[model samples]
Target: MSHVTPALYATLAEIVPELHVHCVEPWCVIGSAAALLAGADVSVADVDLLVSRADADTLMTLWAERRESVYEPAGAERFRSHFARFRFPGLPVEVMGGLELDQGDGWKPVKARRLTLAGLNGLAVPVPSLDDQIRILESFGREKDVQRAKALRALASSPLRGED
Candidate 1:
């Protein structure tokens, strides 16, 4: 488990202000990033963002100037079904409006919504609740997702250091 470093957060603050960023990546500032932000030892390879269809279009147009390559699909047809992938500097970014998680019997749609703020190093980064994250991961049912859900569950049950 690796945590997000101050430098990474700083970079995020510069590239995507908290106001414009909505973290939907489990391994990003919301999942691994939140864990790291909470003092857990965790690290991930890239960033995932959940933005509105409009925002996604805006990002596609705006980031084109800084993108290293053309947008590509993330992975399996199901996974890549709704996502647009690209790279920025040292970060891999995925923008999507919705996601479908495999539930063994069928796929469950995870709809996008207005993101709430999660405090990290004084920055209010948009993120989903721990329960929401766990639900999404559990639905995926992959070994790694199960492991991540467990970690997130543990984090959720623990007390926030400064919260009463």
Candidate 2:
């Protein structure tokens, strides 16, 4: 399992201090990051934040000025709802709201209420619970996600060591 580097946690604490942040990607909380943080081996990449429409708008406005580049507009015609991808201080940041996930047969919208505050190095960042993560991962049903869900399930069954 790959652990979230102290540097990365520090960077997250600095930039997304108040926004509701969640690790929707496998890189941070599904492999090493999850194992390190939750006693499960999981892989994590960049940070994926599930923000409210208001918070997303606030981040869009803030990032638009500070971002190195705008990878996607907030309301691109290609997507069914609002989403934005950008680089903030060299970190890959993805802010999504009202976006739907491909559920094989159809699409399901991601809800913001699923996120709850979890402490990482004493900084409060929002993330889904283990059950929610597993459910979301299962809904995606990709090979990697299935593997991630398996790992997370094992971790969830065990007692957590301590907060990250």
Candidate 3:
């Protein structure tokens, strides 16, 4: 299972409901997780979530016990957000609130232009559309991100684009 495994889907199904109940603002899965959800051939190490700052605070407070205090997020200079990591059964989950990206210009908010619901088992996991995900990856401007964007672009042009 190079992409999402049964264990990972189970972990997400167990956790996402709690987030829906607690988070007041809209939130969606992002990064490689979203790419995987969109049927891209990508490996996902952890789940990345995009949420409102208030929602992030709420989740952080709610899951304080699960917080990984020692783990520091990378790309501090290129990205800024109220970020926190939580431990789950199958994988680690990272939440970024009010995320922004600075590509040498000024800081600008990073958000999904369109969200697509990915059906995983019984859960309707929200993720950015393939095009939006590609745009976001390109905006990051990292070599790895650019590569991921290329993967997503291929998916977008493939027949499986609307399957998600």
Better of 2 and 3 by lDDT: 3
Candidate 2, superposed: residue stretches over 4 Å from native: 20-37, 68-81, 112-114, 159-164
Q: Which is better, 2 or 3, measured by TM-score?
A: 3
Candidate 1 regions exceeding 4 Å error are: 18-31, 34-40, 68-75, 102-108, 112-115, 159-164
Q: Write the per-residue lDDT of candidate 3 for residues 23-131, one digit (tens) a residue.
A: 8877899888888888788777888999999999998999899999999998999999999999988889999999999988889999998898887767888898888
Q: Output the lDDT of residue 29, model 3.
A: 92
lDDT score for residue 112 of model 2: 33
What lDDT does the true structure give each of the candidates?
A: 0.55, 0.55, 0.87
The ten-residue window of minimal lDDT in model 2 covers 23-32
- Residue 164 miss distance in model 2 (angstroms): 14
Clashes of 1: 6
Scored by lDDT, model 1 comes in at 0.55
| lDDT value for model 3 | 0.87
